[model samples]
Target: MSVVVKTSAIKTVRAVTFACLAFAVAFAAAPASAQDMELKIIAPAAPGGGWDQTARSIQQVLIAEKLARNAQVINIPGAGGTVGLAQFVTGAKGDGHQLMVNGFVMMGAILRNKSPVSLSQITPIARITEETQIMVVPANSPIKNAKDLAEAVKKDVAKVTFAGGSAGGVDHIMAALFVGAVGADASKVNYVAFSGGGESLAAILGGKVTAGISGVSEYEGQIKAGKLRAIGVTSPKRLPGVDVPTFKEQGIDLVLTNWRSVFAPPGLNDAQKKALGDVVAKMVKTNGWKEVLKAKGWDDAYLAGDDFAKFLTAEQARVTAVMKTVGLVK
Candidate 1:
């Protein structure tokens, strides 16, 4: 009787094992299961900055369009965006639910911070928009136009110091390119880097710095308040209603615009990648999103995921070449 009982028990165990294996196979072959996904819009800077504003705008548009149940905008600030980037790479890697709203600043951070993961490591979802850079000075600075500033800098490269939001950031790069065009040794020019646009603007307004190289949107309010004077914009054509001249018009050619884009972690499945790209393409079409673009003075530049990826690669190559000329890269 004991021998019979032992045989029965072994048979039951074998049957249970077979059932578990069958379930595993079924689950493996099932469709991608994202019954509900939490979309995290990571703003690489602190609150109220351009990246933060972008993430919030995306969150609002995504929810308003009913594209997702909920989207959260979280601010992860540090290391010129490396802190947030590292957090994203370490935590939500390949979890299709997470998205990062990054700008070209990430490239500068990668070059400077020596981050383990660069922008190329992530999947470029899409580029939302682009904004032209503007040259600004204190409200009452004697330097009036782009030529005036250039003459002063040419007289003595260190006579006027330039301030920017980040070292080797978009503004810094623009400044370097600007000085380089005017037969000036850009390396000899005094360039100061503050934490963000706010601090840089403050330094300029306090007369601590002679001029500032920053995004037009950063000092848009001060421009309105008559506290900041925009002498020149680094665009081929002048901006609408801004009364600012282009650097080209002054015979100092320099055009550098920054773009905002979304990226996901590496190793996403085809379906997961397509789903996120679809949401971005759809979100850009909404009236609400368009209004945000207009309000922020961003150009209506939209590119699909794959196309945007190509653009990033090309832009990366162009920037890499430029940086090499300036000794910023190998």
Candidate 2:
């Protein structure tokens, strides 16, 4: 009787173990669970801009991952993203449903343009990705590489104009920094501001500007089509599959990288912040999201919660110092 009982006990244990394995297998194969909550992602620029693209990507991933039922993107364009920033700080207090897409460009615009609603007034949710700005010239241009561009800029900074996004934006800042790094006066850089890359592309193609500065992705299509020549990228290393070398590699010591990220409105409790951060954190880990990053030509620079807030502080100081050096701020 004792032998029979011991054998029965072993059999029972094996049965339970098998059941657990089956359950695990079923869970792994199940579809992503649907979330009931919907959220609003604000793109504080016109449609077809960087912020709008980021916001739309977030919406796509959030819904496809079933992290949110829907993520609606709203565009509020003006004042280099400050116009919408003011509304977020004042109206979205304690509302975790609202998120804004901004980047390194905002820091310059806020300082140089003297925006009333600074990033400090909002909640820093996450740093999503970083992109390298590119120095591009039209296919017909004489400037062939970063060295050639440097010579042109140093010859007469004002005569060698850079066409890019709005004033005080990352494109503008990159052009200024490149000029300053090459012994040219940063403040003297002839930066022609436009609302979007479309406008800048047209100007560059039409020979209205000496060169163009924008995200490498912004010029990828034209570069591939032989419409534009990418001289150098602001990245520290050459990007894979892209022929352009780094600004450092081209004998220019300047390295300029712009970040794209999300922020929430102030007045949220810790739980609310956690919820938003968790959603983004999960979104980043998904295979779909990883593919999105690859397709969009953005590098993974994900940081969230307390660490992100600290990053905001450091970035504010760093950008402020650069602004002073470039004479964008007094």
Candidate 3:
């Protein structure tokens, strides 16, 4: 009877061990289910801006494709995204479900504001879209074209007030570059920064500012409505379906495009980073994401993995050099 009891105990132990190993193997083999993914995308700017628009587009596509169980966007607007960056770094550390929308604007903002939190703290996922910047004035303004605007800036750089999003953003950078390209003093550019696109649009429409610069899509509706007159677009050549002449065509040697990208929070391990990146990579390839790009007039600038990382590094160096040359930084 004692021997029988001992044999039964050994059989039970072996069976339990084998069952546990099988469960482990199955769990390891299965992919993460959609129900397990809850995404929170940070816009890092108020609504109606490029960052907000990008974040929402991502959210919409992710949900429509069932890539995520749920997704939401949180706006924290200030200091050209530094305010939001600080919050993201602290609040979302080690979280793979959290992503922040950022790009050239934040790059310049970090340098200009000397923000405590920088992009280095985040894991880059991908660069999604690129859009041209449109220079516009109120329809009733005297500046009829890019040339007229150039003359105005040359006449008085300090008096030609330009309204755009954030102090060190792409809009501000374009304004300064435009001034310099037109043989005016870039440092004296009267750039008035606004926290949101709506505020700057109001300022432009009310004629409070001399002109405005923003992404083409942001001002496209107003331009088409005859509320605003597009003077020049920062593209090497005229964009398809966009009637505005290129800055180069207007005899201004300037070309720039604002790119938007997504980043994961810090502290993600290799597997975590790869998992998040795979989701984004999948999203970008979907028809839903492509439709969003087409509707928004955004170019398919999708880049990912080590390629995107290398591009980001190069962009930082390029932006820093340009900012220094324009006197935006010493």
lDDT of 2 by residue, 111-210 (tens): 8878888998998888999988898999999999989989988887778988998777778778878998888887777889897678889999999998
Q: Rank the candidates by lDDT, best first.
A: 3, 2, 1
At residue 158, candidate 1 shows an lDDT of 78
Off by over 4 Å in 2: 1-34, 325-327
What is candidate 1's lDDT per residue for 1-330, written digit by digit as tens?
Answer: 353458889999999999999999655433233324458889988998778988999898888877777889999998778888888887876677879988777777777777787786677888888889999999899988888988888899877788997676787788778788887887665789887666888799999999988777778889999999998898789888778889999889787788888888776777778878888888898898999998888876778656777888787776665566556666
Q: How far off is residue 147 in model 1, in Å?
A: 1.7
Model 3: ten consecutive residues of lowest lDDT? 26-35
Q: Which whole-number lDDT from 0 to 100 does residue 110 have in model 3?
A: 91
How well is each residue in 1-330 modelled by candidate 3, as lDDT tens digits? 353458889999999999999999766534366556888999999898778999999999988999998999999998889999999999998777789999988999898888888999888999999999998999999989989988888887888999997677788888888988999877677889897689999999999999999989889889989999999999898999889899998789999889999999998777677778888988999999999999989988889988998998998997786678666788
Would you list the C-alpha lDDT of every candidate in the order shown? Answer: 0.81, 0.85, 0.88
TM-score of 3: 0.82
Question: What range of 10 consecutive residues in model 1 has the weakest lDDT sum?
Answer: 28-37
Pairs clashing within candidate 3: none
lDDT of 1 at 258: 87
